[model samples]
Target: MEYVFTLKYQLADEDRDHEQIVERLFEAGCDDATVGMGQPGRIALAFTRDAADAWSAIHSALQDARKAMPSARLVEAGPDFVGLTDVADLAGVTRQNMRKLMLAHASRFPLPVHEGSSSVWHLSDVLIWLSGRGSYPISAGLVDIAKATKQVNLAKEARQIEPRFNRQLVPLLA
Candidate 1:
């Protein structure tokens, strides 16, 4: 099984070389990792690993990153959830097509774990649904990466939203 996590780090300098830092993290065994600029002076790292060793993998990667950039401070880290975009990518369909399929086959679709502007499902649930459809050539590894990417984007968006507005939003799925 694969598990995904997103890590945000604060950079001491806003102008720090992000690509170089990400490359170093990659070299440290974060094979499925991607980095992006977060709020000013911050960087976001999203990665996936086997469920059996996710904690070890994340710990080692973060340690390596901290060693490489002494000023990098971990801000937040958590499990990455899958959204419609991830399912669309895994199924080789457009987001519109994915949404349409979900709506048309609502009873057959897995209930999302979270629902807001974009509903989010567990990666395993999406994969099982895709397998049942039997129309898409889906790979678990690819889906894991896509899920992590989607989660990272969601986290960024959440950070950008007003706290009051966000507080009023309730997830459809517990």
Candidate 2:
């Protein structure tokens, strides 16, 4: 299977040289990705990799990226965070219809990860919610990728939380 994803990293100051970064990435089995160096001190790799599963593709990409820049920190792995329009488009429904579904099933709809002017959600959460409702045209591969991305992003975020705080907070959240 070919999985498409983006991995963004915050480069260490010493590793910000574009030419060396690009060559290192390519040599580290990242020839499958197109490296983007837009924001200063940041790099984004948009990859279309062939692997047995989305997880494998993403995992290997992360390893390759790490190999290229050992000091780089992961910023995000995406197609995980999105809004109603994104979910609607993937599910083959209009945004209005998606809004209607959310409004109609306020009690059951997946909660947005962010709630404000424009909400955001973990793509897998919304997809799973729709899948439970009925037959939807959402692709299994997309859902798989969404799930993998969500996990990657969440794990990245988790590493930042202080262990003592996480230990205390875990039981409370549960």
Each candidate: what lDDT? Answer: 0.69, 0.93
lDDT of 2: 0.93
Question: How well does candidate 1 score on lDDT at residue 118?
Answer: 78
Task: Put down candidate 1 lDDT per residue, 1-174, tens digits, no spaces.
Answer: 666667778888743876787777777666676777867788877766665444455556667667666777666564445688877886789999999999999999988878889787776567767878887887665455445444544565677778776667655324
Q: Which TM-score value belongs to model 2?
A: 0.94
Residue-level lDDT tens digits of model 2 in 1-174: 989999999999999689999999999999999999989999999999999999999999999999999999999898899999998998899999999999999998988889998999999999999988887887788889899999999998888899999999999985
Candidate 2: count the clashes: 0
TM-score of each: 0.49, 0.94
Regions of model 1 farther than 4 Å from truth: 1-7, 11-38, 45-59, 66-79, 143-174
Model 2: per-residue Cα lDDT at residue 98: 93
Model 1 collision count: 0
- Least accurate stretch of 10 residues (summed lDDT) in model 2? 133-142
